[model samples]
Target chain A: MFKPFAFTLAAAVLLTGCSAQSGAETQGGGLADSLPSLTGDYVWTVNAQKSTVKFEADYNGAFSADFSRFAAAIKLNPDAPETGEIHAVVDLSSVRADDKDVTNNLPTPAWFDIKMHPVATFKSDQISKTDAGRFIADGTLTLKGISKPAALTFDLKTDGNAATADGNFTVNRMDYQVGTGSDFKDESWVKFPVKVSVRIEASR
Target chain B: MSASVKSTYTKTAIWLHWMIAALIIGQLIGGKVMHAMDPAPLKFELYQLHKSFGFIILALSVARLLWRLGHKPPALPDGMKPFEKIGAKLSHIAFYILMIGIPISGWVMVSSSPYIIETKIFKLIPVFDLPGVPRTEGFNALTKDVHEYMAIAIAALLVLHIGAALKHHFVEKDDVLNRMAPRIKVRR
Candidate 1:
């Protein structure tokens, strides 16, 4: 009898200890905390009306949804892309799918868990030019409070003061806990990879 | 009321009967399989296909009803009791109502859902939602429940209908089953 009670006490203590650590970690940090300070010649603000942030969750079939509201700030010089920085904030609650059922369930715990983690963020640590008009921004993508290293490659075309970037990237859905459970392990229904595509129109 | 009472059903009646019967059974099984599935892309596709089948059944049911009205069926065997005859008639009426109700209810449920996925029949023909249907969660849930109950009712009706047909064939030893038999030869 006493052994069971002592075991229960130990488990409770361990659970509380874990929660306390996580709580502190989540509250203490902000999305921009780790971003590199940018001092590039051109600071571009993304036009929300003109830009689109969409994701495709594919298994055997493809179901796509879009983040209706997102904002990205870029500081870069076309000549020195290595010194550039990109930061984007996505409102997880604003995700809308063509199917109403999909839209309603997206903010739930199985997917974005928008109640607990309402915002997803990306802040680049490195930006490198692979070719004349193409660049890759490697960054930490924080979603549902889980951070993972991700990369976005885009073709940048600049004409005078206006610029456009069309990019696509793939991220493992399981890595960010988007659909991690016994049911989703096989990936028979909703596949593991989620493709995120972005088109940004911005000006200095 | 005709001078010569027809002993067997017309070819058109037989054709519609078997076609609708096969489709309804398929819909019942497909509905069960799709409902138990986890929410995924394939599940969504199955639902769209299911919707396509539902509409097809609805259309066929309409055609079947019209065909039924224009063509009087062969008279029941002389020995069928009053209640049995009534039950047979009632069950058929119920089937027609259900075949029509099930698909329409499903359509209403789909229309009411807040998430609007376009209904593409077999991923080919685009079928639009019923106009003026309220797209609310409560309405959608209610319609879904109604659709499910209608499906259950149809399943029960199927058991009764098949049992009656089997009884007419094996126990009653009549030509009732022979009327709808696809390729059976009969002496006029």
Candidate 2:
């Protein structure tokens, strides 16, 4: 189980390195254009204040929440929305809930199992938008070596120079079988459904 | 000065000796376990502890040597065989050499290393400068080799020392572990 996780981590690092090299090349030789842009590098800054991510269950009122450190990169082609690509990593381990008890339990092997599976990642296969300014990001969320079909939706707004989008989704932690919850240490009532709110910045 | 050399150590001498022994044991294990870790904030943290403790070994070694000249070591048991005495003395010499050499080399290795500081001393003082011999990229690799090979040699010697002590305890029936033991007997 951890073998694949380790391999993927190494692969992720390598791919990230290659992508950064390519991003650097694309960033050169031009003044970045602002407002409703998609060609240059655009980083989605997670607005923790506006973002609310929570996981709920029968036994627990709200045992899980993700903080503002959530971040990702999106390569959007505003003219050709089909070509837009998104890569985001929610350091689920980085999630700091206001509740101390819940926060302590989140990083354990029985929970996020941060030591073995450190980062939870989402890479979009296809992203589409609705006429209502709401956006849909479809991709496989790889958690603990288990890949599942996951879709996220939220509101997106673009002014003449800047663009912003938000999304919320719930995932049954058991789908990936993150860890078998316990009554004392692990809470089983709520699935690890993460709500994502993102704001991306790009040059025109 | 006598042909029949001494066998016992003074109170302060024994304390320094065992303290160094304890520190070396702790550091070797620390270095081994820490080196096994991948690069992370905590792994680097462990390396800092290991490095600081290593420097302690270097400092203690110097102090121990300085403290030794002022003290009179007790004579060996009058009944010991001649060749055994020569061999015992030779091993002690090796131990002293290794005590200082290995850590100096480690410091040199760290100095030559571009990333790590020369002195992680108390985490207070940063690297001032590396003393003795020119510092270069090549020196780092060479010092690393020296530290590693010296460790192998020291470990081999330690195994031999223990084997000899066990041999005396069971076969020779001499108090081989006596000097390093809880109590030493003095003869008039």
Candidate 3:
């Protein structure tokens, strides 16, 4: 009885390992290898009124800041996601925290350094469809005079003349020199991983 | 040692009374010390803990009030003066009012404040603001003053309550203190 049970457990473990390996293989495979590349030029204007960018930081407790002003330019073909291009600019000065003290401190030199770098930009170099209605944009994010490569995975829904894209990604604040000195140098107060989320509604 | 003396309080009442007393004292100290500290992560954590305890005090006060309504407390010792009885009743009434008022005022201040930080009980349970409280600077300041003044009033009353209990135990040599004290068996 013990021998048969051990054999069954081994088989189960092997099947789980094989399934996980295949999942990784599918994701690692290039988008072009799985889907046909669409080849059409389309322009979409980001509706600022319906769009929002928010960042959540964990400092003993979870708190979020919202940016009101931003602009984006998108050129994509739904049939050809690989041919898509996205460029966006976020007004760092427009960041607002729910707490008055945090809101006042956010634009100081220790944090966003909004006086020196008032704008953060993201330019996507490649876009790939990972699953139905799901896509990932591999891009460069420039903030506080530092540029770093970041990947944003988003879900897209298009209806008639309107399209909406929503996604979230985590960024290490230390990488961009945000809150780099004194009390903020360590993870004692504010954790490094800040979750950034975006919801963009655009019109063709 | 007679059973008819009725010298002790019900176990549930005694437990609630002591629990609320200990928590309130700790909360008052935490609130004062945390307020004096500068704005830092530790200060923030202490304030959250203070707020959590404030709500716990409120819940316990409500439960204690309900229990008091259902059960009569042990009577004062025989031959107690009329003025002393009135003083005791009035002071006990004030204690209950302050116990309930301080936390409610704190809740109002938090709910009305323009600063929109979330209130979590013990950093675990998320609590929303009380409805209809205006989120304005003027309103916030008013509620804050109320909360602070009421807290001071509670502190004053706590001193008096403890002093009265001590007097009853040491001077009057009555069961007033023993009614709320933990039960202890005395060997013959």
Using lDDT as the measure, the top candidate is 1
Q: Write the per-residue lDDT of candidate 2 for residues B38-138, one digit (tens) a residue.
A: 54547757766777777788888888888876766666556678998888889988988998988877877876653323355667655444666455557
Model 3 residue runs over 4 Å out of place are A1-71, A74-204
TM-score for all models, in order of appearance: 0.61, 0.45, 0.56
lDDT of 2 by residue, A1-204 (tens): 221111100001000101111243232111111112324433332232333333433223534354333334456544444566666555455566655546656676656677887666666777666655555667777777677877766455555434445455666667767545342224333435444333333222
Which candidate would rank higher by DockQ, 1 or 3? 1
Model 1's CAPRI class is incorrect
Clash count of each predicted structure: 1, 14, 1
Evaluate residue B33 in candidate 3 and report its C-alpha lDDT on the 0 to 100 scale. Answer: 98
The parts of candidate 2 lying over 4 Å away from their true place are A1-204, B1-7, B116-118, B125-127, B132-136, B183-188
Between the candidate structures 1 and 2, which one is better when assessed by lDDT? 1
Scanning candidate 1 chain B in windows of ten residues, the lowest lDDT window is: B1-10
Model 1 misplaced regions, further than 4 Å: A1-204, B1-5, B39-41, B186-188
Return the clash pairs for model 1, or none.
A100-B115
Q: Which structure is stronger by TM-score: 1 or 2?
A: 1
Q: How many residue pairs of model 3 clash at the backbone?
A: 1
* Tens-digit lDDT string for candidate 1 (A123-195): 6778887986777877878888899888888877766666677777788888888865455565876788888
Q: After superposition, how far is residue B122 of candidate 3 from its true place, in Å?
A: 1.7
Question: Worst 10-residue stretch by lDDT in candidate 3 chain A?
Answer: A8-17
Ranking by DockQ: 1, 3, 2
Give the per-residue lDDT of model 1 (tens digit) for B1-188.
22455877888888878888888899889999989997776787888889999889889899988989998998988899999999899998999999899999999998886655678788788888899998876788899999999999999999988999999999999979987788565454
